[model samples]
Target: MILQRPGRLAITLAIIVSLFLLLPLLAVVPVSFTPKRFLSLPEGEWSLRHYRALVENPAWGAGLWLSIRIGLISAALATTLATLFSLGMWMLRPRFGGVLMGVALLPMVAPPVVSALTLYFFLITLGQANDLVAYDTLAGVALAHTVMIAPFAVVLISVALAQVDRRIDLAARAMGAGVARRIFQVILPNIRFGLVSAFFLTFVLSWEEIAVTLFITSVDAVTLPRLMWMGLRDNIDPAIAAISVLLIVLVTLVAVSRALHAAWRGRKAG
Candidate 1:
């Protein structure tokens, strides 16, 4: 089957939609460089003071570092657990697998406020009992993020698992391969792309998580999103706009690089 190229009208509409979605975010670029202390577009002059504040302010640095650490930890934990659960469900095809999958997805489907409140009370209760994994601690926040994001990993990895040929598993078993070897060498290799997708998806979810983070953390584990929220609420600091611009640039770079790499691969294959 041959696919037709999009018509000029379709291309025009696509560009219009893209610009509509991106214009609001693009507005922050000038605000980030405003000479004024607050968030506003530059009047006549621009300054980098807000960008400098990201480096000079200890709170910003600490929040950024903490956010990176928590995102990494949550992504790792979510990916590992989701992989194991997805593998088990795919291989075993258990009776209650659908129910279990639904249970795993509750955090994602439930209202954010409900999930945040539930996690808040649970962590608060635990904090009263123990210091470790307590409310406002890094561990607690990371754990909350893991629970909230793991379902996404589960869905991605499960889709990857579904695409694998069952014959491969049977063939490996017929050759007297053990379960561990079959999984590590054969199954996992087949689903590597899914694993990567899940890892990055969960990492992004955890990185920008603010509702749950607001509930679970305070002084000690203030993540970048949480700090940005505080800045917006309390002072409407220009530094928040600076960070937003940086994130937008970073995401744009990654997206452009990936698109270029895919184009290069397609051309090579052609």
Candidate 2:
């Protein structure tokens, strides 16, 4: 089947909308290069002092390293749990699947503050018994992140699972493929892209998570976003603008590359 090509007017409108949405993000680029200490656009003079500070400042370096570490751990945990939950629902098609899904997606839909408070109280209680899950600890922050972002991973993996044929699973089962073998060899390979996407998505969510992190962490697990929030709240540092610019550029590059790849694949398929 042939698809209708977008009209020139439609394409023009899309470009305009994209640029408008990106305006705020683009504005940060100039501010990041400002010679001033505070957040401001570059004047006739420009400097990379703020960007340099990202490396030189011990707090920034520590926050960045901590964020990376927590992001990885939480992403792995969330992906593993999401994969298992999503695969179970897909295979079992249980009577309470809808209810289970709603419960799983609650974190995604609930207000950040609500989730944070819930996690905060839970961690506080858990920490009383287990130091590992105590408030202000790295493990606590990681667990909070995992809880907050797992819903997103579940949604993405479930969408991928929806596209998979049920008959394939039945065929594998009829051929005497055990649950473990079918999952590893059949299901996982088929959803490899989705799993990768979920991993990266959850990692990004954890990296940028500040609301819950703020509730669960203190000096012990100050993430990049938490540090940036502190900097913004205490003093409007240009260093935050530098970090924002870097993140914006990185995300834009990844989005563009993925779009190009998808278009190339579409053309090849056609």
Candidate 3:
């Protein structure tokens, strides 16, 4: 068990790496409280001015709201489509599953610039360009996010479905259960964790997305990250740091909560 031991060298190396990764974030958190309008290491006085400004600014608030709404819509659409497709692939074991999965994964694997250009051209050709139905609309942004995140959902859900015992399906069939009943009563309950994980992963991906969003959206449908980009161009402010801190905290809380829930459930089952 020497490998498991907290040897001095290993502990020192771990701490060093952890601090290296976290230093920027740690620096940002305090800067978010700086009294100065510009970003800097905190000086004589720390203040909540930046946070207050973020909350009070209409443009920032609007962008935040739009991002949240679009992220939720995109996550839901991606999760539903991915879950259904993954389930179908599992049930049928069609030869095309490999091809379909590969196609679905293209959005994630391809360079963002290439995908954005292709999608832009495709949208324009379909007569969606510059119209409400075309680029820059909230719906359009959501659709793009859905395409980007669905493959991740499909991958996670497929792994979960693979873990399921095939005999369970046979048992349900032997009991004369219809498709709907079997899915809801047996399959869904067993794969609940997978579904939840897929939902969270897809949601987080959409929420944090920037590259494709940048190419595909404009002022009307601008998201939080887009707004942050604008802020970067105009000025460096503590508000941007505050927003980044908020996002990091939110994602951390979500991940910890999911882990705790899974642990509690396992304990209960035992």
Candidate 4:
């Protein structure tokens, strides 16, 4: 009982710290329902006015659709490349692989400004900025997102690979399983969860990307974050609150669904 006291105190302190960070999120939920022209607490009434604007406004819808499309494309490309690289690295057991892994992690580790600046310079050197981003675009932002997100996928998939038994791979290779067959048959099936996790994570990261997108795009590739940014600067429209609310609800539902799925799988396995 005495030994557990410190642990209980630590857990309680952790929960307190978490709640402190989350208080702002909790406060935003009600403000999202406010019917006022400006942001404030709803004193007497609440309305769906802002939410209606989100649904009816063409700009919001367009931004959302574009974000989703780019997110999907970037996620697919990043996850596939990460999976292949992780599998290949494990197979090769290269001497300088640690250094390579560190280089791969630079995007995630470096400050946002550094990555943004790097991509900006890289873009200018390659082709016209208008063609890549502002004038009209899909490929530009999608490709940038893939590069920024690939490291996350690599780390996740590599962790999944590490959990696998090397003996299975060795046994397969001994039995004359070619490189491709060994990867597809032995390594991949065990890492399905990691692949799903990486895909979803990359999709979310791409969807929320702002710094790099801000540098690369002007109008043509305007994503939801950019739109919201413009709105904040221009109008601080009440609709922004409603969008926040919807995003919060959507992400919460997805999280809950994932948790339920994991629980069900655990039970099934047990």
Report model 3's TM-score to 2 decimal places.
Answer: 0.88
Error of 1 at 161 (Å): 0.8
Writing each residue's lDDT as its tens digit, candidate 3 over 10-84 gives 999999999999887777898888888888877788899888888898888898899889889988999899888
TM-score of every model?
0.97, 0.92, 0.88, 0.88
- Write candidate 2's Cα lDDT for 126-207 as tens digits: 9889888789988899999999999999999999999999899999999999999999999999999999999999999999
Question: What is the C-alpha lDDT profile of model 4 across 1-270, one tens digit per residue?
Answer: 455446888999999999999788778777878888778888889888888889889999999999999999999999999998898798898999998889888888888888887776766655563555422267777888888999999999999999999999999999999988888898899899999999999999999999888887787778999999888889788788789888988988988998999999999999
Q: Which stretches of candidate 1 lie above 4 Å from their native place?
A: none
Instruction: Predict model 1's lDDT versus the native.
Output: 0.94
Residue pairs in clash, model 2? none
Which number leads on TM-score?
A: 1
Where does candidate 4 clash, by residue pair?
none
After superposing all C-alphas onto the true structure, candidate 3 shows an RMSD in angstroms of 2.9
TM-score of candidate 4 on Cα atoms, chains taken together: 0.88
Kindly report which residue pairs in candidate 1 clash with one another.
none
How does residue 209 of candidate 4 score in lDDT? 93
Superposition error at 234 for model 1 (Å)? 0.4
Please give the RMSD to the true structure for each candidate, in Å.
1.1, 1.9, 2.9, 3.1
Worst 10 residues of 2 by lDDT: 214-223
- Tens-place lDDT per residue, model 1, 238-269, is 99999999999999999999999999999999
